[model samples]
Target: MKLLKVMLSAFIFYLSFIYGASAMAQDLSQQNKQLLANFANEVFVKKDLTNLQEYLHDDYIQHNPIVPQGLSGFKQFFADWFKAVPDWQYRLEKIVAEGDTVWAYGVYSGTQQGDWLGIPSTGKHYSIHAVDIFRIENGKLAEHWDVIDTYGLFKQLGVIQ
Candidate 1:
């Protein structure tokens, strides 16, 4: 009878352990989603790369069609873009995250205050819809893929002509 009680207690403990682990995983996933959202809004939209560095891995990979490469490439691109449009800001339309993957949809808009792609400043204000997918590992962004309306941007900047 004592052995039976011990076996039953072990079974209950095992079940509790499993349930506790599952709950912790769920909570971690939710926190990750919120972290991604905050990174996009506070870092990208706010153009605050100082705090952004903390959330990005050193080996970050970016798979943007225009600038396909590492995190350094993205940083360079942003630098040049910001030089031309210093006030560029993103307005997040939606964000959806599952597991370690996050998708962010937003509009990037700014006034052209400097030269871009050899085009002189037009002082034109433009907005382009953009979507970015990020993969996080160990709570840091490891990889990213982005799509933006480059054609529209070029058209607005009169660079295509």
Candidate 2:
């Protein structure tokens, strides 16, 4: 009878451990999803940088060649781009989060009215599709990588045939 009781107690403890970990993971994923949504709305759609620090860690790493590494670089890239494309807008189409990673698919549209990356303003309009992947750490964006349709963007801008 004592052996039976011990075995039952061990089984209950194992079940609780498994279920508790699963619940914690689910909650983290949900929180990360919400974080990305708010960040996109405030920074991309609204073009606001006042709260950038709240979403991005100071050592944030960017894998895009056009943009430099670190949080300061990310901020500078956007600030310059915003001036170059006054009507620039990013529309998030889909987003998925798992563990500490989040993926966002979106489109970027803008009209060039100022210089950008040595390309003078031609008043040309361009729309590009891009998929961005981000890693979250301590509830903030720690790293970023993206796949953008540069060929299509350049073709639309009349920079290529």
- Please give, for residues 1-161, the per-residue lDDT of candidate 2 as tens digits: 99999999999999999999999998998899899999999999999988989999988999898998888888899999999999999999999989999999999999999999888897999999999999999999999999999999888878889
TM-score of each: 0.77, 0.92
Q: lDDT per residue, candidate 1, 31-92, as tens digits?
A: 77788888877777777666656788777887765663666666777778888998898888
Q: How good is model 1 by TM-score?
A: 0.77
- Stretches of candidate 1 above 4 Å error? 1-25
Query: Top model by lDDT, which number?
Result: 2
Specify the highest-TM-score model's number: 2
Distance from true position, residue 67, model 2, in Å? 0.5
